[model samples]
Target: MNRRRLTRWLTVLLMSTSNLLALPALAADEAANALITRLSTEVLGSIKASASVRTGDVTTIIALVDATVMPHMNFKRMTASAVGPAWRQATPEQQKRLQDEFKTLLVRTYAGAVAQVADLSVVVMPLRASPQDKEVVVRTEIKGRGDPVQLDYRLERTSGDGAGWKIYNLNVMGVWLVETYRSQFAQEVNTKGIDGLIATLADRNKVNASKG
Candidate 1:
């Protein structure tokens, strides 16, 4: 997808997450919607107010994500899923490296997308999910200029440290994030083994860091 499309949906994704620093006491059924609530505007304000954040600075965005986004995402699950079956073959260290690099890639890309957006507001749709369900799709639309853009999330309920209904994947314009990365990751794994894929990600992150 083009950068603008990625930016549009990513802005929705990133802004929707700022409130995750504190999960609600509400049940899982309501938690997703509540988490995606208008409180997210709080983060948007913080971002827009900061000159660094508005400039698409990865360092600034990384700090924001490290605090808000990291705690609520199933990054292990996200990384594993994106790596496909090759994840099983990876050593623990390799797995950790993959997760770190993948996360950096996403944060840096998000930095760019979020920077370009100056007019956007989120409207979360009613979540059609059962409390008994372990996984659910939370649909939302980005409202600003022109027609609203569609963005959705895939969250699975979990327990343990910093756990609630954590996001494992995201969907934008009918494109699933994990699946999109999987196609690219799988190709690198096939050509150069798991280590090769890790190296590629590391190289990419270094380039991104340099650009920042």
Candidate 2:
């Protein structure tokens, strides 16, 4: 092969490898940003439109939470793991009931918390690192009129396969709410059994729904 042709082929190979290495990082960033934007907009918009002047806003918010939020949640895995060793001992019916009620309560709680969206803006910060091929953490600052809150969305990438870059965890003000709930849930299951825990969640959700 001629010297020029050999050099050209080598240059092309190098560029192709560089692009391949760069693609995942770039895609991860884009996916993370898109999730951040879409969720923040949908959530904030729902709150603003429903926070007042509507009695059925709670229902609407709950629907939105279930539709947009629930799919992204790893609720079965979350609940099973959160319940710890007790989860294994529960009857099939008990497990089903626990997962069902826990999902409902979490949706309601998250929907209720949307009331705090008033006068809040989220600033998506630069990611420290892209940790996995399928997941990324998008750091953000949530500034309310009262105080600035640190938030992070731990996102999973599906990348146009179907509603890509879903959020599985939301850290608000340095509190990983899901993790906190998981720990608390483990304790309740330890002390009271799965059925008792389900009852507690139902009661808590009832109160929360009334408030909403």
Candidate 3:
């Protein structure tokens, strides 16, 4: 090839390489932002659509969560993190039980709170993460009466048959959900052990259910 042609070709090749390197980061950023916005819209829409849900009915909210929220959440990971080191020692059966109770506690607890705030609009904050990051926090504000409530989600990009981003943890008003629960679970595990933690969750869920 001519000298000019060769230089142009090399420049084009360099540009293409740069773009290729940036694609993963761009893709991850867009995909994660879209996912968070979509999930928030869907949950809010469902809550607004159902009067029973707006009334803070746990049963209705449970249905909504199972249908809309649970699919995107990595509750197993959240539970394991919450349970801390005790999780490693627990049998499979115990783990399952812990997951069940933990799920119930979360659903019942937030179900009522979110139901009450169904009318509020969620504004997604700018996502601050690099292209190489597999896990990121998507921050948002729930706008309604009083100050805007801070709601943030920690999501991880996973690969496999169903490869995509999954939400594993949450933060409300600067307090991280898993970390908050971890402290309680750790205390329980320290004194009461794994079964004790499970029992505590189960009891809390039961009380919340009765209140609901």
Candidate 4:
């Protein structure tokens, strides 16, 4: 892999580790560990086999992403929140289209980054404060042979019985990915209307499909 691709994969892995940190300790950690184990065993192994047969096969990568990563990520909510006021102004169909397209874009981007998962270890640290009543930031460290990187998860409670924590943002080495996306979305909405923004996302999705 090129240096740029490796850097992108490292960024995605760090973001995943960071977001996995925001839950209520063991519950969140257990859920994430289970997911990782499945991915490492079933999904990763399959991807490796496919790569050995046909190196850099985009179809296999996208398939692995859809099966393993897309199911775990709440891209609809993330996209809706990132769009901010534009979501409120959009029609129902428009909102749905935007969400679908944006979700696909994210899935493709993250799937492409999955190539960066190395033999690194993710250590979930204790939350210094309680998150029972409100949102909290959980911290963790992704350690490798090189320097350890810090990851922080910004999560909030869903509307139900507080059964799960939904991750809305993640910080890796001090960079917040959600906030960055929000800013980019805001700029797009400013330059182009909501429909234009939706079109932009649709165009990106089309590009991703073409690549696959």
Best TM-score goes to which candidate? 1
* Tens-digit lDDT track of model 3 for 143-179: 7676766667788987753456767876766777688
2 or 3: which has the higher TM-score? 3
lDDT of 1: 0.74
Q: Write candidate 4's Cα lDDT for 1-212 as tens digits.
A: 44344445544553333223333444343443343333323433443444421243446544554454433455566777788878889899988888777756665665565544545566666565553545667676657667777666665554443244455666767766666677888988999988888888889888877876
Model 2 Cα lDDT, one tens digit per residue, 23-107: 3344445556654654555445544565441233457645554554445454566677667677889999988888888766655
By lDDT, the best candidate is 1
On lDDT, the stronger of 2 and 4 is 4
Error of 1 at 170 (Å): 0.9
Clashes of 3: 0
Residue pairs with backbone overlap in model 3: none
- Where's the lowest-lDDT run of ten residues in candidate 1? 20-29
Query: How well is each residue in 61-171 modelled by candidate 1, as lDDT tens digits?
Result: 787777777766788999999999999999999999999999888877567666555567778889898777888898878677777767787888877655567778877
Q: Which candidate order results from sorting by lDDT in descending order?
A: 1, 3, 4, 2
The Cα local distance difference test for each model comes to 0.74, 0.56, 0.66, 0.58
Stretches > 4 Å off in candidate 1: 1-4, 7-12, 23-30
As for candidate 1, its clashing pairs are none
